[model samples]
Target chain A: MKTVIRSTTLADKLLFIALTTAAVAGIFYSREAMPKGSDVIIEVDGRTAYTLALDTDRVLSVPGPYGNTVVEIKGGRVRVKEAHCPNRLCEKQGWITRGAIVCLPNHIVISVGGKTENLPKGLDAVTG
Target chain B: MKAVKVLTVLLLLTATAVSCSNGPVEYRKTKPLMDTIVTITVVSESDRKADEAIESAFSVISRFSDKIDFFKHTSELSAVNRNAGIAAVTVSPETLGVIERALYIAKISGGAFDPTIGPEIRMWDFAKKVRPSDEEIRKNLPLVNYRDIVVDRSRSTVFLRKRGMLMDLGGIAKGYAADLALADLKKEGIAAGIVAAAGDIRAFGLKPGGEAWRVGIMNPRQKSKADELIATARLSNKAVSTSGDYERYFIENGRRYHHILDPKTGYPAAGCRSVTVISDDGIFADGFTTAVFVLGPEKGMRLVRDCGADALIIDRDGGVHTTPGLKKMVAFENGH
Candidate 1:
């Protein structure tokens, strides 16, 4: 019983250490990981910027640089998919899937959101 | 006995776990751009899918056009403009809401924030026209009266019984728009964020790591560098708007012509350079700031303090004053 308890504690310690290491590693990796191809350059009120893969556009929106300056692509139209900013003006802005996503108030520009990656997909989120 | 101890340990662990949140709920980016004389900060993050929301929020509030401005045109207010003689004619929900808030400010300012000063604003040539003669000013003076405009919230309409009466919401629209945008961000799954329209700024939730969003208060006198910063405000959802004479003004015979007009004499208020109000709604903040500017600092501070909102005031002499909340949350970078 004593040996079993010791082994259990050892396993718990190892798991905690692994999780801590993975969390730090993930942050560093995400900061450095580069897309294999061109990214869409989003221009904001002028400067504050962000970079995202095409897949991230639907879930994340950074508006000027104010409100949900959202842009969505649908039916050959690039529209502001949704926003709570009165009147859903971002929804009226229409879409841009390729180049830059501009949120003037937030100053977030996704210079790359929707480009295909020719590089092999090795490190899925789980692997990280 | 052993089972009870184990249960107690489990309860403690559960309590600790419950206290820890998932992560920092928001992110932001600030820059020095807007008027070139001041710095603009914008932060963004998502609690949901479908990005690109900020772009849509800003253009609507920031755009300056005669058309599509909720302030300039609402069905009820339009009807009032057409009816010059009625003491109070019926209006709509949008107009009624705006006018009702305008009256609140008007009463608070002791008549400084009047929505009926539309003709006076026109006479100044700040938004439209070049200028008006003294006769033109006097002729329209009688039309400016918040008392003449009544609101029936239950009926959902505003009535202007007087002729030539127009309610201009330019004072509050930007702040209101900013408030709307911030709300929109939260609705779209922004756990933490900040939104501003030129001067109307609103922040919410937590920083990306649960830290507060630090907002730098620009020095109105210097116009370069924010002399103060308001940090540690835990308000996840609120709007901050400042009205200053710096933006639009003209020189005529060595005097400045600012946009905010007092309904009494139909001219700019005597003192104060800027008045900033922070609240949960941009519309209230926007209009209150303008009205406060017209009302001057002493009363402005009282109104802000009474409403439990925060405010920063820069007097005409370049003196900076703040309400209790501003003094607590704001740090003066250079003797502010």
Candidate 2:
């Protein structure tokens, strides 16, 4: 009876180690596959005008109701380089790695990391 | 005995695998609507359901936009403006509902948040960078009174008592849109998500992992940096709106002029850099931000307390004043 009890205890210890190792490995792999900043999306008058890669550096002129607003993406960040709107609020809103740059008068919006899936889980939307 | 031990190990491994894959998946989409960016986020186990909810929410927003967009001549709001003082223009029930709410807030705020400030807004021409002459402003100031707006609930029509009294629903329209979008989502059986229109946001139900949604307030001083947050608030099942002087402003001759006008003075309201209000309704949150902003800190705090809402007002001197209830919910960022 003593020998049987010792064998059962040994089996329990081995099972515990095997389960924990597998769980840790699974968690590590999932974390490594998490999404990052991949795309920059620009919308004009609520319609998507551009979807470009973040790693690319370029400038594009987006025409709006008021006039043309220049959008610049550089070094994985995006911003409004110039705009014809009087206040220049969009241009003043500097580089954004995440979140959005909204030019209300011109009806243009530039969002970094286009989809919400690429962003963290807890943040649903940004408010002023 | 050996076979039973191996079975127990397999069962434990399978349980761990299930637990690891059980985290909620978040889905979000941004569409340009109502002259601003509208973002909707949903967390659920089913991707198909999230997509359906977002589609319905956007449709609701589009329907409201078609009714209230002041700039769009085809919109119902344009019809009302064109017939100002000539006749009562028939409108949809949605437009009637928003106008009624706007008038109610205008009465409560003593006309500080007037939807009839369209004539004045057009004169400023923020897009064109032109400031209207003082004479032009003086002539248009009298037309900026909310008391002049007449709403006929029985007929579902709206009328401006005076000619040239334009109804610009910029102040209150987004809130109404957010509220409607949230309602649409709920009807579609999506209980965990947020519907946000720029500065106006409405969050409902729990976030993933059963945590409250964390909302970051942008620092007015950090105008150039979009990610520089002044404070953060944890909330669930509520709406928040912020009106800041820094949002749309131009500097001329060392004087900074902003877009939020004081219906009384016909100039940009002073005393606060930004005012954020959180409440159960988006319309209230959006309208009150402008009202509290025009009222300044002392009067604003009084109104906030009376409404049973939470507020965080940043004065021009960079001092943060929050209501007692908001004090617990807000955590200031470093240097704030």
The model with the greatest lDDT is 2
Per-residue lDDT of model 1, residues B209-256, tens digit only: 555655444345543212223222334566667676754555578776
TM-score of chain A of each: 0.32, 0.65
> With candidate 2 superimposed using the best TM-score fit, by how many Å does residue A78's alpha carbon deviate from the native?
7.5
Q: Tens digit of lDDT per residue, candidate 2, span B16-132?
A: 777668667667887767755688988877889999999999999998999898766789999999999899999999999999999998998888788888888777744335678
Model 1 ranges with Cα > 4 A deviation: A1-128, B1-76, B84-92, B126-129, B223-235
What DockQ does candidate 2 score?
0.30
TM-score of each: 0.58, 0.80
DockQ of 1: 0.04
lDDT, candidates in the order shown: 0.54, 0.81
| DockQ for all models | 0.04, 0.30
lDDT of 1 at A52: 34
